[model samples]
Target: MLIGIPKEIKNHEYRVGMVPASVRELIENNHEVIIETNAGIGIGFSDQDYIAAGASIEDTAAAIFAKADMIVKVKEPLAVERAMLRQGQILFTYLHLAPDLPQTLDLIDSKAICIAYETVIDTQGRLPLLAPMSEVAGRMAIQAGAQTLEKSNQGSGMLLGGVPGVAPAKVVIIGGGMVGNNAAQMAVGLGADVTILDRNIDTLRSLNIQFGSKVKVIYSTLDVLEAEVLAADLVIGAVLIPGAAAPKLVTRDHISKMKPGSAIVDVAIDQGGCFETSHATTHQDPTYIVDEVVHYCVANMPGAVAKTSTFALNNATLPYIIKLANLGYKKALENDQGLLEGLNVINGKLTCKSVAEAHNLPYVTAKTALAI
Candidate 1:
């Protein structure tokens, strides 16, 4: 099998798909790995590193795509990259198709075997490929929120931890999942009064056990969210709905009630955001004022730390890439239920229910699609 690794071309996306170690693994399996020239440079891996790992460096993406059977990538294909996709070729990447109709249409038209990393699930109901990036984005959510709190950034000139005579800032997190947990951990460590709300009582109970007196766990009702936003100096929206779009829990009307200068970092922006006013922003201009409320909704927060993100993402995705490469898409998906969940589209048919439902397209089960 011939595998290709392309440099991520999304705006400000510096994370590459495969690391040197990943290339070495494929080489050890007797698979040929081709990496586009300068693909790993943004993530601090030199082309020489890949060459040392037995990967041949191609001068152009077109060259890599032309010969490789499977293509691994960090992000969903952008318009230009989408145009390069070949029919029946395998694309293994974070294809968040629910919110992007154009991307879904492009994949369908290209007739590629699109296995979305975000949709792949383990038996534990956890997204294996999406977890590493989620962890990075979750931790960074707090770091980004902290920076946006500075007065110059238009946030309520408040310190997260506050000084001796002053009260600490209020930090409200919208979900109790991985992103929310990490954000809350950071907010609590900074000595801010932290409150985490979730629709799941079990999750809230778990958080209560973990944080004890340091973090407050609350039932996430509309009234509760509104009241919390009114007092919060920093709000982190960490809600998710797997492969589907995130529910807008915070509305523009709710934003109107939030205190002026309060900051909101919507970590769920990749899944179309849980905040009504949210739009995909780039790292260059990450924040905007909505009713005087600061919104940090960069779609690719992990891209800001490309080196760490690339390594972490490869740690999770490399094994799956090898499976698809070794067995081919059908045999691999047929054997592993978890991998089957990753199949958004195969040879132009929509195989993932969430993605098909998102666009009202005909849904085909992976079993049926693979049979063809």
Candidate 2:
């Protein structure tokens, strides 16, 4: 099997799909890996580095896309790249299709086998493939929110960790999943007043035990969420619904009621955001003011830390990539139920229930789509 790595083309996206070490692993497994020129350059891996790992370097993404049996990418393919997809070709990447109707339609028309890394689950029912990036994004949410809280950024002139005799900022995280957990870690480490809200009692209990009074864990309800958001100096929207659009927990009314100059970091922006005012922003322009509240909604937060993100992402995704290349996508997916859960589209049919439901499209189960 020939695996292709194309340079990510999303705005300010610097993470590469495969690193030199990952390519070497594939080579050791007797697989041919072709990488587009400069695919790993953003993360300091030269073409020579890939070559040293026994990967053939192609000069153009077109050639890599056209000739490779499977395409491994860091992010979802952009419009042009999606246009390049061919029927029956394998696309293994983070396809956030629920929020992006156009991309879903394009993938369906291309008739490609689309396996979303974010949707893949482990035996523990954890999102193994999405964990690395989620961890990165979660940690970065605090960093970004703190920066946005600076007076120059039009945020409340409050420090996350106040000095002696000064009060620390209140940080409210709207989920108890990976992103919220990490955000709470950062916020608490910085000496801020941290509160995390979630619907799961078990999750809230686990978080309470983990934090042990350093962070407050609250059961999420409309009244509680609104009160928390209103009181927060910095709010982090960390909600996720696995392959579905993130619920809009923070409505426009809530934004309007937020304290003047307070900031919101919507880490769930990739899944359409849990904040009503959230819109995807780029690193170059990461914040905007809405209802006097700063909104930080960079969809690819992990991309800002390209090297760490690429290596971490590779650690999680390489095993699955190897399995796909070694046994072919069908056999690999058939062997792993978790991997089959990653299948969103195959042979022009939408295989993910959430994605199909999101766009009112016809749904096909992964087993039916694969004819297993």
Candidate 3:
């Protein structure tokens, strides 16, 4: 199999699909790997580095797209890259398609085998491919929120962790999943008054045990959530619904009532955000004010730390890439039920229920689509 890695074209997305070490692993499996010129440059992996790992470099994304059997990418392919996809070709990457009807339609029209990394599940039912980036984004949410809290940034001039004489800022995190857990870890470490709210009693109990007295775990309900958001100096929206669009837990009314200059970091922005006022922003201009409440909803927060994100992502995805390359998409998906869950589209059929429902389009089960 010939695999291609193209440089990410999303605004300020510096993470690549694979690192040289990942390429070397594919090469060892006797699969040919090609990297577009300077594909890994953003992450500090020079073209020579990929070459050293036995990957041939191509000067044009067009060539890579035209020749490769499978296209490996970090972000979902943009419109132009989507146009380049060939029928029956494999696309292995993060495809947040529920909120993206255009991309879903494009992938459907392309008739490509689109295996979304975000939709992939492990035996434990956790999203393995989306976990690492979630961890990164979770930790960074506090950093981003802290910066947004500065008076100059249109935030209440409050320090996240106050001085000896001052009280610490109140940090409220919605959802006690991976993103929320990591966000709480950072917020608590910075000496903020951290509170986590989730609907899952088990998750709440787990967090209670994990942070003990340092973090407050609350059962999420409408009244409690509203009160917390109103009182918070910084609110981190970390809720997720896997491949579906994120529920808007924080309403515009809530934003209007939030203390002026208070900020929110919507880590769930990639899945259309848990905040009603949230919209995808870029790193170039990440935050926007809504009702005097600052919203830091950068769709790709992990991209801000590209080198770390790239390596972390590669660690989780390389094995899956190798499996697909060696056994082919059909065989690999059939072999692993979790991998099959990653199949969003194949041969023009929409295989992900969440995305199809999001678009009100037809849905096809992966097993039926693949005749498994």
The candidate that wins on lDDT is 3
What lDDT would candidate 2 get against the real structure? 0.95
| lDDT tens digits, residue span 200-319, model 2 | 999999999999989999999889999999999999999999999998989999999999999999999999999999999999999999999999999899999999999999999999
- Whole-model Cα lDDT of every candidate shown, in order: 0.91, 0.95, 0.95
User: What TM-score should be assigned to candidate 1?
Assistant: 0.98
Question: Which of the two candidates, 1 or 2, achieves a greater TM-score against the reference?
Answer: 2
Q: Give the winner by TM-score: 1 or 3.
A: 3
Candidate 1 C-alpha lDDT tens digits along 1-372:
999988788889999989999899999999999999999999788999999999999999888888889999989989888888899899999999999989998998899999999989998989888888888998899889988999999998898998899999999999999888988888888889999999999999999999999999999888898999888989999998988989899999989888999999999998899999999899999999999999999999999999999889999998898898888888899999998988988788888788778789897898898899
TM-score of each: 0.98, 0.99, 0.99
lDDT of 3 by residue, 1-372 (tens): 999999899999999999999999999999999999999989798999999999999999999999999999999889999999989899999999999999999999999999999999999999999999999999999999999999999999999999899999999999999999999999999999999999999999999999999999999999999999999999999999989999999999999999999999999998999999999999999999999999999998999999999999999999999999999999999999999999999999999999988899998899999982
Off by over 4 Å in 3: none
CA shift of 218, model 2, Å: 0.6
User: What is the descending lDDT order?
Assistant: 3, 2, 1
